[model samples]
Target: MLWLDLEGAVNVRDVGGIPTDDGEKIARGRLLRSDNLQNLSPTDINFLVENVRLSTVVDLRSPAEVTSEGPAPLTRIDRVLHVNHSLLPEHGFAATAEALLVRRKREEERYPGDPSCAHYLGYVEHRPDSIVAALRAVNRSAGAALVHCAAGKDRTGVVVAFALTVAGARREDIIRDYAATGERLDRILDRLRRSPTYAGSIDSVPEDHHRPRAETMEAFLEQVDKRHGGVLSVLGGNGFTDDEFDALHRKLRR
Candidate 1:
């Protein structure tokens, strides 16, 4: 159970090896985090399907996002669950990306810490049905599961955070997982380029659209701490069950 350094995958990490408060570590390779798979190389796809034995791929993007950028087709995997949730504002990814990019141009303007970043996490907090749906799929999957979204840092990050928390992972480990997105930026953007939306004009999207940085991801995670005390509250408040928590811990802790 190690995180595979796939040639074209961004932010791909084994959600394991972080010490919890009780001194346990997350089981490696049982869970993985990554950006969209729209441009997965055939080799990469084969590795996940044939070698990793991935049983599920939970997509957190909205319907428009998925339709605009179709993901890589999966094989005999049990299911490809689609859970629609807007990490950005109501209009969708394009609008939010542009706003973030504009903010980036102004002095002292930074992502992750910006007010917009809070709105992104707010949506996740107030409305977690989409996130829960993805987790439920993971619960039902037969083997390893890979979860992703565009850049895999915000929406995907939050969901992965909740998953880790449910599995009793440490906050520091969760932060490290979010921070890994920065290391895989180029690999993610390369895949973004293959999307039809990736070719749109700058006016239509943000300059930082393709790059999901660690700083921004950290800001989002910080907001989760500031707002709900932790991911557990977010899930509990939103409707997750104690049984689900126990089940997730059992399934992921090894």
Candidate 2:
């Protein structure tokens, strides 16, 4: 895990240099995963744009969150293309407590064993189109592509996992990368807790709810294999063409 020393973001890292099954390694500095970019400092912005050469930002934040937070600094950059690929519907005027309760109930029902796995599954079940679109945007990027959600743990994790799987990265490496978020859970939660958009929600949640376990991602990948046959099959089922799949693979693998 190559962590980026950004002024605002804590969970940012370059998801490269992992060994693939075919003895090839993922290209360095081409793919990054991070938490929200709303608080990125000017220096952070310049670092990403100039040093990282970030050309595309695949934001998986919901419409409601985006509206509340306003445009991110990267969104204002002329050379960088920001794409919103929300996996869930915008929360209406419902009370926060009610929305959270309903979401928890749905996640519990989705997967009885692990709530994290269920929440990840919901991303695919609820918005297959958005997942496909996000992957397509990643494949289309001319330079480095950064994928982020609010915490860069769940939605971002799933998408990054898919990208790594498609690139033939070792399963152990994938799980290790997913579990790496747990190392920075405290910082991530603190940053999110300071944000008005997530403060109220995260304040009421347990610490474990914010942590990412290797088992959660292991189960998620297993479910994907068992239910959808594999990552490629899931992408194909979700309308990703063969050429797009090939392009994504080529973009990641050296």
Residue pairs with backbone atoms closer than 3 Å in model 1 (clashes): none
Task: Give residue 163's lDDT in candidate 2 (0 to 100).
Answer: 91
Cα lDDT of model 2 by residue, 1-254, tens digit = 69898997999999988889988889988899999898999999999999999999999988888888898888889999999998775443222756886787888898887888988888877787888999999999999999999989999999999999988899999999999998889999988888888887886667787789999999999988887788888889989999988899999977
Give the per-residue Cα lDDT of candidate 1 at 205.
Answer: 47
* TM-scores, one per candidate: 0.78, 0.96
lDDT of each: 0.66, 0.88
Over 1-254, each residue of candidate 1 has an lDDT whose tens digit, in order, gives 24677756666776767666678888765777777776567688678877777767877776668778654555323344333454444555552455645644541343344643654565564457777777777776677777887777667877787888787777766777776676666656666666566544333445465454455556766767787676677777767788887878877886
**Candidate 1 accuracy as lDDT:** 0.66
**Model 1: how far residue 152 lies from native, Å:** 1.4
Looking at model 2, the pairs that clash are none
Top model by lDDT, which number? Answer: 2
What is the Å distance of residue 232 in model 1 from its true position?
Answer: 1.3
